[model samples]
Target: MSNHEVRMSEWVDRVLPSPTAALESTVAKLQREGQTVHRLGLGQPDFPTPDRAKQAAIQAIEDNFTGYTDTGGILSLRQAVCDSLRKEMNLSYEPDQIVVSAGGKQALFNAICTLCREGDEVLIPIPYWVSFPEQVKFAGGKPIFVPTLPEQGYKTTPETLAPYVNESTRILILNHPNNPSGAVYSTRELLELAAFCQRNNLWVISDEVYSTFVFTPEKFTSIAAFPGMKERTVVINAVSKSYSMTGWRIGYAAAPQAVAQAMLRLQSHTTSNPSSIAQKAALAAIVGPQNEMEPIHNEYLARRDYFVEAVRGLQGLECLVPDGAFYVWVDASYWCGRKLLGRMIHSSDDLAAALLQEAGVAVMPGTGFGSPTHLRLSFAVSRSELESGIAAMEAILGLK
Candidate 1:
């Protein structure tokens, strides 16, 4: 090994590998060895990119629009983003205030880097997206976790987050239509939280990546829509989930001009700009008619209902029906600290491993998201795959 590799910074050394990626690799290896693995660990949509978006990319390539665009994104793409936000969410934003990136992941990292400094503290609700805490650490900020339990539907209230705020609290990250929990905050709840942030002079990073996947009657409201919040809120969203264009790698953030400029600077130094073809595809996605996207949302809703019902059949496992995202965060603590197949199952990690190795099913351990006793099961796969995975897990737990 080279001596240069041994002299890496402590931050790089202490950073742990993403549990989601680790589980994905394990499943890939299992499949390589000819083991049939039903993967419910990663939350990727199993749908192809929309035909219109694919056509747009093809046209862009044919038109020779392959060169690098502006770091903040091409003007047409930003305008499309603004128009989509207005038409769909009734939220108003200017194209100049948007910063398009490789994906919603990069948009979030840019927000963290631009807003937080060393020793600054960011308030994140527990059972968060696995990337949040790690992103904060990468930005040289401390992540203060506020636990949100299954009883509360895994949604944190203003009360729950209040105590975590202090003089050093610079940002609060909220992933509504949340990743693992699928918790979508109500308008009233969001208003209350927005008021608190406005009073504290704290920045709000509202991640609405799953905004369009909401299944409830209550409408999804953006924090940026709250009065006085536009100046302080960085709204991150993408066409990845809404248009089933995950592989296109397109996402953007809408924020105040100053914040947007800061992110642009950071992005210029790092990624420069998102893929030109992907940006064109995203433009097509945002500008296209909405009826084409309905079937995807309906499919996810059916899968959510099916998985929640199946989980309910398991005696010890409890899951809340998520309103937006295609995940069922189940409390599998009943099996924690118990013996399973002659090995001590002490945490969700152990359960996940046993499920993959012993049952040929893959699920994400909640400890990666700061909830050690829970497990996240993605219903994004086919109904048959979901059924098989759940049945295998039930047999492993002796529930069937």
Candidate 2:
């Protein structure tokens, strides 16, 4: 190859950079340059890691426990995960059925790679987490997009997913408390979808990373809790979101023994084990008291209420009150084909750019989440930051 020419894996070419990360980088650059940019783009929780977890990591370091661990994580950590799952979600699993990885992203990659065969189709709901389709493609699976309606709470039901199923369909990737839309599935909804998966013989890779952020009256329920699902479902979760430990990079998956073993093998050749210190931290977080959890959840709910109201009051922006997670998915289609700041607004990408550059606000464009007509605003920051961001946006777009 010539000096100017580069060669990379085909998989690299198939996947796109994560839009959320890109926006974060841009915001960081602007901040470094002394610009006042209000951040509403990232889904990272603003809370600090729990003190118990922090002390655990410090103790682990003091005790020189920062060595390589079992490929599937320390047995104790795995057992803690099993106990936590049993207590929190009414799910039963053996420690051997769990494969702990570097983070939720890695755990998801492991699941997709292990369960998907070449050319098999994976059902992905639109407005999904940015990584879903790309990971499926990297695993040599086709991503079949299934659209869900906002009126239906932006959730996929059996009816919405039925038309996409065919002979080659192998898996359904379910994200509830969905990332961009914050749509949490009800038990009845999950039951119907579970039955549909049973009928179609499809496996499920349930991304429950945001499971603890539900704002609904009913508690969070995993599809794996349904009948006949544990055998075919891979439940992925992490300490990153719930425990405010994103930087620690600890995540895991619970699946059937065969699937867990396959994923463990895949992880063995990749990241052998997650950070030993982080594992210790996660252990403490999992087994320690959770008195602070209720307050954190309530705070997020309050922020969601305020942000959703503020967003809906903006011109050319409409949104539903999300049931879970900390994002408001705003339909900005009304701004498309209109002009803003003397520039023609064609899609959410343009709107997002204009907002960032002209209004000093950072928001994620929906193009990466499979919608060009939407924008995702996160309320996971401080209330002051959220208010500032909303005010900056209102200054530019005007209030309804």
Candidate 3:
């Protein structure tokens, strides 16, 4: 290194921090100045870690279980994840097929970096998790996007995806009970996609972190569960969303043995292993809880039911009826070119800024998620927060 060397932006430097994190920081700044803030920027579920899980971590510390385990993870915890997947989703994975990482984000990164290379193109559905394309870009792979239709619940069909596939296509990233837009693919629909992938020899990376939170009649279908599909799919999951243990930083991917081994090698050099105490907590969360899911699901479903109806009932606002996960995708395209919130608004970003500035409500703009006409609002907070945020929105936008 030399003093003459200047900082530069390569693909490594191309990634931007999430707009959600930026909005959250702004909201914190405003609140520090004594403004009333209704926080709705992050997809954080407001539930405490289960009693048994918390106690397990405490007990782990008391018992001096702080030493590192296998870089892949403790054998027992990996086995626990395998058992849970088999029992709940009927998806089977041997211990060798799993690579535990810091979080689902890292798991996806490890998987992508392992599988994709220069000139490879991965198919990403639009309104994706903000990090998907960035991860692909960092891996030296091109991201070919296929847009999901709004009227179709934001789920892509094989017909819509056919145009995006080519000889360079290598992987198709699927996020069920999706981030930003809560669309869950049906098993039959996934089977069709599976057939298409099989014909094209395209590998699948399924992010099922929100696997447990389907609302109403929507069912969760892991793409790997499709017949003969496990060999081509890397199933990524975490306890952060379902078990409300975001800070635990534990996530794992179940892939074909070769793919798992590659990610395992990557993890060895980079993260080495996730936190041991977090693994203990995650194991407890995995094998201990049988009750909390239902109540939390009920609360989220109710919030979705009320929030969608309220959002759609408003004269100018439009929102999709979310099938799973805890977000409502509000279409703010109509507000373009209108003057409100002390400025001329032209896109979702403007509307988001306006809402936060005028109404003291922090909602995420959809630009980072690849949709400039929408906003992603999370209902993962308490019911009261939802009400307050919605009230602020209505008052400012005159939605009433």
Candidate 4:
């Protein structure tokens, strides 16, 4: 073998560096050198994990439950997941149909690897989570982005996706309570899309990680609830957002028997199983009392109200009142071609850089999510921090 230079996988070459990480690293580097940075670039919650879940992990360690668990995950955790699905989502699943993964990210990855093949197309709506398109490419499938504009709430309608569907369209990834845009699909909206998928014989990969964070009066409905969707929907959920267990890395996927088995086989060759202690902690989160979640939900609701109101009042920017998730997707197209700090800004990337460098505030650029004229501002931090960050941005944008 020649040692000079080696050819890499085509998929690896096509995948770009995560925009979230790139922006965060740049801000972190600046802050490390004694610069103060207000981070709104990443979607991490600032709250602490509930004491009950943390104690469960400590107990698991004390009991020496650190051995290898079932590749599908611990039986108790899987059963808890089933119960959660039944109670919350009104969907029934057996333990055999669920597979615990390192995070919701991995659960989606496993599903893609198990289902998609070379030359297959996965329909993704923009603005979408940064990882979805890259994961699809890594799985050797084509990511066909369905562009959703700010006027349409940054959500793809069933009609919009119809043009992209064909025999090669293997999957359609739906992130209700979306990442960049916190647009939650209503029941009527989901029914229309479900019908389209059913007609086209496409699989539905539902990323419901933000299911619990809905703020509007519109009730949360799972696409799997639709008739015939159960057979094709792979529901990906996690303890990360709802339980404040992001660092714990506990997530799971529920699907039909065949898809579950395929994901299990692929996981066995890859990650094998999720962390045992984290799974035990997640079991506690699911089976333990419900009172802990209420408080967190209430707090997030308050933050959402405050941040939305603030963004709505900002001049020259269009802010969508998100129905779910802890993000505000702001249309900053007004800033394009404008002078900031004596430099002309042309894109979302430039706007984000200017905010971080000149305003000492960090935000994710919309180009990463397939919308080049928008920006995502996370309000998961404390109210005081959010206030300061907004003030700084206002000063930079000349918005009072």
In model 4, the worst 10-residue window by lDDT is: 1-10
lDDT of 1 by residue, 166-227 (tens): 89999999999999899999998888999998888899999999998889999888888988
lDDT values, one for every candidate: 0.89, 0.94, 0.88, 0.89
The candidate maximizing lDDT is: 2
Provide TM-scores for the models. 0.97, 0.98, 0.96, 0.96
Candidate 2 weakest ten by summed lDDT: 1-10
- Across 176-240, the per-residue lDDT of candidate 3 in tens digits comes to 88998989888788889999999999999999999998875745778898888999999999999
Those runs of model 4 whose alpha carbons end farther than 4 Å from true positions after fitting are: 1-6
lDDT accuracy of residue 382 in candidate 1: 88
Clashing pairs in 2: none
Number of clashes recorded per candidate: 0, 0, 0, 0
Give model 3's clash tally: 0
List, residue by residue over 1-400, the lDDT tens digit for candidate 4: 6733878777788688888878777877888899888887788888887788889999999999999999989999999999999998999999999999999989999998888998899999988899999999998899999988767777788889989888899899999889979999989889999999988999999999999899888768899999999999999999898888898999999999999999999999998999999999999888988766787888888988898888766655778788899999988888898887798889988988888889999998899888888889998899898888888888877662
* Model 3: lowest-lDDT 10 consecutive positions: 3-12
- Model 2: per-residue Cα lDDT over 1-400, one tens digit each: 7724887788788888888889989999999999999999998899999999999999999999989999999999999999999998999999999999988999999999999999999999998999999999999999999999998989998889999999999999999999999999999999999999999999999999999988889999999999899999999999999999999999999999999999999998988999999999999999988767989888888888888888989999999999988889999999999999899999999999999999999999999999999999999999999999999999999989
Prediction 4 TM-score vs. true: 0.96
Q: Residue 139 deviation, candidate 2, in Å?
A: 0.3
The alpha-carbon lDDT assigned to residue 253 of candidate 1 equals: 97
